[model samples]
Target: MDRVLLSIGHGYSARALARLLKPQGWRIIGTTRSAEKAGTLAAEGVEPLIWPGTEIGPALAQATHLLTSVSPDPEGDPVLRQAGTAIAAAAPRLSWAGYLSTTGVYGDHRGGWVDETTPLTPSTERGRRRVAAEEAWAAVPGLPLHVFRLAGIYGPGRSAFDRLRAGTARRIVKEGQVFSRIHVEDIAQVLAAAMARPDPGGVYNLADDDPAPPQDVIACAAELLGVPVPPEIPFETAELSPMAASFYSESKRVRNDRIKEALGVRLLYPDYRAGLAAILAAERAG
Candidate 1:
């Protein structure tokens, strides 16, 4: 049987990917920060390894496939700082390695379309950290390093509909502000497809077909829920957290042609409307 290792596996997308791959007879090994989450992971049929800046042991060196969703903070990534050496030591044995990054690395493209070949010029500290982390992982020898630049990820219980129901949905308008987004399930499928092909040293942009304004997405959600659309607020007048406002500063449409051509996969939710419909359906059924 084939085996896969997932670092920082206790995330929304990682858990979904584990479930998707489990039925295909792949032995899943996952790492978590907490012992309690490790126990939960074990119950979910994943071989849970506790890694919290401590020794990573031989598990880092033995996996056939590796995926990491760890984000870099001011203190930096513990797994990479400590266990990266172990992974680098084991790189020669690995088939494929994937690092999840963000489209924020492209910075504000001014609503222009960006593809895999676009030069990275991240504007924010978080995006800069991600770029740095990408460089760190790319430096590893003998590993098939693949970087996935993900857009706004939404799925299941985590959609705009939930916000609308809670009466907290906002339609903040910034002129020319648009963002590309992708459902979490599509992200999993893309990752799986890339793993199957094992593209070493390749970069792929993951996004949906439509790149719409933020207010449009919220209005669509309200329309789907049969509720009044939230009133749009000017960017200056809108109450937004520092992080949220930072996201609005960028206006880029990420292209998915490379993922389609290379991975041979199609997005389950091509846009927010379709994705919202599915989430609403699931909520109704439950």
Candidate 2:
């Protein structure tokens, strides 16, 4: 059987997964919201369709696997709301399916550890919507769904390096404010492993072993670049947008035991230090 993947809301994380799958002879149909992005996707060998304006049924019929990276809004999940019926009709033929969710669902842990079994008690409105979307996905009968709740996502182009270079980096120190994160490469690997070993309804938390304060990561990146570290600013005094402030409202360390034990997955960057170094190295090597 041909290996075809229908990736809805194909964004950063989905692109990483595509890098792995495309090299392994998989055909990917990704959805974007713009014509320019569709052209870019096509350049990367992805078949892109403008979503919300396009019929997803034909793509669903072609897919042996499915993944949705779309976040929910005030209403609900876009994929479920728009193409829920097509997905259900195509469910039985799908070999595997996955959902990209945020660790924010287990909100306000006060820097405590949370596992897969942690009860969903989101603090933010965005987190609450994810909980709703997860429930909605679960309601779809016969869908081979696996939910991966990701932590603060950082990578080559989207890390502290960008902020430091842009002169907008700040070491915002909030006491006991620690966050778990995963390298984009590690996330891609874990997703690949899950597809290889499909276990429907499996929930995994994807994060690095290190759960350090935001200041520490900024310091590490600055040191790596041989530049002066950004000045530390207390969270209370930091002038932040509401969106940025919302991120500081929760603190937690997410456990990645299930991915290791169940899928035999090994992370490339187990800590922020290692992940930062790798990103910096990739830039220099390029």
Best by lDDT: 2
lDDT of each: 0.86, 0.94
Q: Poorest 10 consecutive residues of model 2 by lDDT? A: 77-86
Across 1-286, the per-residue lDDT of candidate 2 in tens digits comes to 7999999999999999999999999999999999999999999999998998988888999999999999998999988888889999999999999999999999999999999999999999999999999999988999999999999899979999999999989999999999898999999999999999999999999998999999999999999999999889999999899999999999999999999999999899999999999998888999
Highest TM-score among the candidates is held by which one? 2
Question: Compared with the true structure, what per-residue lDDT tens digits does model 1 show for residues 136-244?
Answer: 8888788789999999989987788878888888999999999999999998899889988987998999999999998999999999889999998999999899989
Q: Give all TM-scores, in the order shown.
A: 0.95, 0.98
Q: Which stretches in model 2 have alpha-carbon errors above 4 Å?
A: none
lDDT of 1 at 284: 86
Question: Which parts of model 1 have CA positions greater than 4 angstroms off?
Answer: none
